[model samples]
Target: MTEGLLTAKAVMERLSQSGQRVVTAESCTGGLVSALLVHHAGASDCVEGAFVTYSNQLKHSALDVRDETLARFGAVSAETVTEMAEGALRAAARATVAVSVSGIAGPGGGSDEKPVGLVWFGLAVNGKKTKAVSQNFEGSRTEIRWQAALYALQLIAGYDE
Candidate 1:
């Protein structure tokens, strides 16, 4: 299996042991993060569910990402990503941890402010503790998405707060 998949499995194992569950809210990477999390055996034990909100409209409607957030900071901003994570946590009250992703993964749709491969990641844990990270990956669309998913999994594996 790929390193990314392996990392996801390891994360799932840890969360299961801790009696915690995880949920995913995804955007630019589509459902890649959720897919990787469930690719391993026994994932059902720790994975709650996934929300694939690929559009700004979907982000607003499905995840309750504030329209003002998207309008002011755009979909890939820290604000929008954090809202996505919060939305996931709210939607899955049983999940102790949640991760959200949004980005511009493309050979197009990039501007000076938000380039292709520019991604934002958000994590939300119980007590509503949260963090947001930004990454600029270098590659084709598929490579960018794969790397984004892998990075998110790695964060979960090392999370302490």
Candidate 2:
């Protein structure tokens, strides 16, 4: 199994044991994190749902992310990912944790500041609290996505503690 899948599986098991549930908000990795969660059998017990917000408009409309934040920080900022995590938690009330990802995973869409493979992740737990972190990966689009998924899953696994 891929490291991401194994991490996700372990996280699901932990959440199930703790009687907790999880939700996902995705961007660059698209729905890959969510897909991994549900890939395992019986994941429905712990996976609440997934929100795939590819566009800034969708991020605002679906996740209630502030337009000003998006305008100020852009989609891949830590601010945006934190909002996404909080919004996912709000949307999936049953979930005890939410993990979010946003990034520029491409051969293009890079700037001197935010280059390709720039990813931001956010984690939110039941107390309405959230944390956001950024990572710069080096690889092709596929590799970056795989790394993002792995990181997202690892973050989720560590969220409760």
* Full-model lDDT, candidate 2: 0.92
Clashes of each: 0, 0
What lDDT does each candidate get? 0.90, 0.92
lDDT of 1 by residue, 1-161 (tens): 38888888889999999988999999987888888889988998999999999989999998899999999999989999999999999999888888999998898999998999999999998885699999999999999989999988877776665
Q: Compare the candidates by TM-score and give the number of the best one.
A: 2
lDDT of 1 at 89: 92
Give candidate 2 misplaced runs (Cα > 4 Å): none
Cα lDDT tens digits for candidate 2, 1-161:
37777888898898899888999999999899999889999899999999999999999999999999999999999999999999989988898899999999999999999999999999999875699999999899999998999999999888866
Which regions of candidate 1 deviate over 4 angstroms? none
Best model number under lDDT: 2
